[model samples]
Target: MDTIPDNIILHPIGVIRNTTKQPFLVASAAGLTMQGDLAPTMDRVRESEETISEVILKGEFTELLEGIDEYSHIKILYWAHGVPAEGRSLKKVHPMGRPDYPL
Candidate 1:
């Protein structure tokens, strides 16, 4: 594997404040399956809806977001805490661990 460069830097601009206690999820068998079958009931519950979440900006950057609510959609990039920048690599993933779907 190639070595990581030292020039990169990342600083958190804001936080995703939500009611989610377990803020981490993956395609682990324990989390996505029951008796080797897809949990259809749970899957619908996990599907996103118009839930409330606040993107509280940092104190210094609060002024930078002056007219953000005018847009219909706002793209937010959340930094996964404790996950490294170079850790992402996925050729294919069975969406929700169902064999029929590979994303």
Candidate 2:
């Protein structure tokens, strides 16, 4: 066995306004329903030739939604998980269900 040297480091950029301090509420509410209201800017849903999708901009971040309608496409980054956990590494392939190759 060999020890690996650490070369990369990570730092926190900002904190979230919504916090789940209560344990039971977080567990029971998991996957049941979503809280809070959707922003009005997201009212205009866009549809492609084969698919339909809405641009959701919620909460305090809604203030930055001004003048976004002029763009044809937008990129969004999000943190899906509120807490980190030990899980499988990043995978390039489907977990044994895909019939086609994925890049």
Using lDDT as the measure, the top candidate is 1
Give the alpha carbon lDDT tens digit for every residue of 6-87 in model 2.
6645343333433333222111222221122233212311111234434454456676778988999876554535433322
Q: By TM-score, who's the top model here?
A: 1
lDDT of 1 at 14: 84
Each candidate's lDDT (Cα)? 0.58, 0.37
- Stretches of candidate 2 off by over 4 Å are 1-49, 78-88, 94-103
Residue-level lDDT tens digits of model 1 in 15-47: 887665442334342333222334653554465
